[model samples]
Structures are given as C-alpha cells and as structure tokens.
Target: MTKSEKTQIIESLTIEFKESNAIAVCDYKGLSVKDLESFRVAVRPLGIKVQVVKNTLASIALKNAGADGLEFRDTNIFIWGEDQISLAKAISKFAENSAGKFVIKMGFFEGNVVDTKHIELVSKMPSRDELLGMLLSVWTGPARYFVTALDNLRKQKEEN
Candidate 1:
C-alpha cells in the first residue's frame, strides 16, 4: 500500500478506536480461513467489526488516538466497535472451542488497558441490557411478594 493509503487506513482506525466502547487484541495466527470467516459471521451479527491489521499500524493508530496505553504487540487482530461486552463474549466463546487457534492478548475499555484475564472477566460480564433487566427484576421482587401476600390474605378473609 502507498503512504497515503496507509495514512488513510490509520486515520480510519484511529477514529474507530476513539469511538469504540472496548477494543480487544488477539492473535489469529493459526486460525483456518473457514474458521476465521465463521468467527467474523458470528461477531458481525452482534455489530462488532473484526479487523486484522498490522500491529505497527494499530499501535500507530492507538497513539494517534491518544490511546497508547493499549500496548498491543506482535501480530494482532483487533476486535472492536459497538456493544463491546457482546463482542468479547463472542470471541471468548469461539476461543473456547478453537483453543490454540486463537488467543486473547489484551484489551482496552473505558480508557484503561486490560490484560487477558481482565478481558476474560469483561467477557463474562452481562451486557448492559441484561444487567438492566436483572436490576429491574430485583427491584420488583418486593412488590411482587407484597401483592402475593395481599392476595393470600384476601383469600383467607373470603374463606372465613
């Protein structure tokens, strides 16, 4: 690629890094083409953009975006975009089966550089919508119990 083309690509990557909710660096060295395609298909449906970019280019883009703390190294494929936790979960799930074919390197989230273990933890976390639903269920538990108790009391009164 020409210098201008590389610059444009880097600019685009910088923009993506800036806008992303989370960014994960992974090694895709041993993945077969079919497996990689399958991985892409799985992640794309969840609105994640998975790109295999030169590690130097990614580092440069991260620096340009003032996110040098990401600390990506080696040949890295970047998985980033919307709904970061979902993307992480999808990748983690795929890796669980692929094993040695793929591996998590590092991740960036909320302006912090997360190691592989932290990335795995993030992957295990519930999505925002799921967390919200769980919180709603918890919040309504007392109300539900109160209503049930009232119904039982009315049933007893009617039987008397």
Candidate 2:
C-alpha cells in the first residue's frame, strides 16, 4: 500500500484502539476463507471487529498511538471494539469448537496486557448487561420475599 494509505490506516486504527474496551491478538494462519468470514460474522453481531493486520503496520500503529506494550511478533489478527467479555467468549468458544484451528495469542484489556489464562478468565466473566441483570435480580429477590411474608402474615391475621 501507498504511504498515504498506510498513514490513514494507522490513524483509523489508532481511533479504533482508543475507543475499544479491549483488544485480542490471534493467529489465523490455517483458517480458510469461509472460516475467517464465519468468525467475522459471529463477532460482528456482538459489536466486535476482527482485523487482519501486518505485524509491521500494527507495530507502527501501536507505537504511534502510544500503545507500545500491545505489540506482537507473529502474524496477528486484532479483535477490538465493544462488549469485551462477549468478544473473549466468542474467541474462546471458537478456539474450543474449531479443533484448534484458531489460536488466541494474547490480549489488551483496560490498558493491561493479558495472556491466554487471562483471556480464559475474561471469557468466563459476565457481560455488562448480564451483570446488571444479576444485580437487579439480587435486589428484587429480598423485596419479593418480604412481600410474600407480609401477605402470608396478613392472611393469617384475617383468618384468626
């Protein structure tokens, strides 16, 4: 690609990196076109973007963007955008279900570098919405129990 195009790509990538909640690096060496597309389709609906980038260009972009620790030496596919936990789950699930065809290299979450173990941990994390729902359920459960007990007590008082 031309210098201008490369510059533009770096600028655009920098913007994405800044906006992303997390970034996952993966190896897509043996993946077929169909499988790659399938991966894209799976993550896209969850608001995650999968990008195949040259390691050199990625390094340049990372350096320019001041994201130095995010560098990878091997062929890297960068996954970044919204819903980090779901993205991690998607990657972990794809790795688990794809017979090892897709391999996760590492990740960057909340400005911290994450290894495979961390990625697995992240995959197990509840999504933001799920956590919110759980919080709501926890809050409502006590109130519901209190109301039930009050209703039962009122019925006993009326019968007596």
Would you give me the overall lDDT of model 1?
0.85
Each prediction's Cα lDDT score?
A: 0.85, 0.85
Q: Give each model a TM-score.
A: 0.89, 0.89
Counting clashing residue pairs in each candidate, in order, gives 0, 0
Candidate 1, residues 19-131, lDDT tens digits: the string is 88788888888888899888898788788888998878888998887776766666778998767689779878988899787998888777878888887887899998899
Q: Which tens-of-lDDT digit does each residue in 1-160 have in candidate 2?
A: 9999988888888888888878889987778889988989988878899989888787777666556686577667898876779989999999997787789998888778889999999899998889999999999999999999999999999999
Q: How big is the positional error of residue 122 in model 1, measured in Å on the Cα after superposition? A: 1.6
